[model samples]
Target: MNIIVTRPKEDGSPLKEKLETMGHRVILMPLLRIVPRPRAFIRKLPYQAIVITSANGIRALSGHTELKSIRMLTVGPQSMKAAKEAGFLKVEAHGDLVGLATHIRKTLNLTAGP
Candidate 1:
């Protein structure tokens, strides 16, 4: 069997190696590349909450102590996990962006800083 894995390199490499061991040829062609922001470039700003769509976003905010005190909204389980691991006390996970937006509108007061 020949398999084409279009996931990112960090995600597809493990599956590719596993399939090769199982007698299948695997092509690890990542469909998108993740360009990480410089660590020093990101700092805590005046915001009520931070919305993170991916685990990478949590990773990018690592080492910023000021972010731990704010609310963290994650798009999925993976992002939620990352936010938790990063020591965010207030973390909420939504299934998708639409749901996240709905949750935000329902629970968050717009008068507060966003």
Candidate 2:
């Protein structure tokens, strides 16, 4: 089978390797680039928890001093691992966005608001 992975080089390389090992032709054509923004102060606000859908978000916030202090709710195992590696002490993982929202709604009882 032929596969074209549009993810960035850093992300697609491993997948390409794995696919090739499985006898698949993989093409690397990165569709997006990850650019880390300059560090900024995360305002101290009264919020129940922080929700992250991607590992990139965790990477973006990794340098922040406040990352370890907040409770993190993330979608998927990779995002959970990234959050933990980024020094997030309290982290929860869900299968997808819907699951994350359900967990938040049931456990945190938060329908809306910051």
* Number of the top-ranking candidate, with TM-score as the measure: 2
Tell me the tens digit of each residue's lDDT in model 2 across 1-114. Answer: 999999888778978999999999999999999998899777877668889988778888888866577888999888898788889899989899999989988878465545
Tell me how far the alpha carbon of residue 103 in candidate 2 is from the true structure, in angstroms, after superposition: 1.1
The sequence of per-residue lDDT tens digits that candidate 1 reaches over residues 1-114 is: 999999779767877998999999899999988877666655446787888987767877877877787888889787788789889888999899999999889988888766
Question: Where does model 2 exceed 4 Å of error?
Answer: 111-113
TM-score per candidate, chains pooled:
0.72, 0.85
Tell me the whole-model lDDT of each prediction, alpha carbons only: 0.83, 0.86
Cα miss at 74, model 1 (Å)?
0.6
Clashes of 2: 0
Per-structure clash totals for the candidates? 0, 0
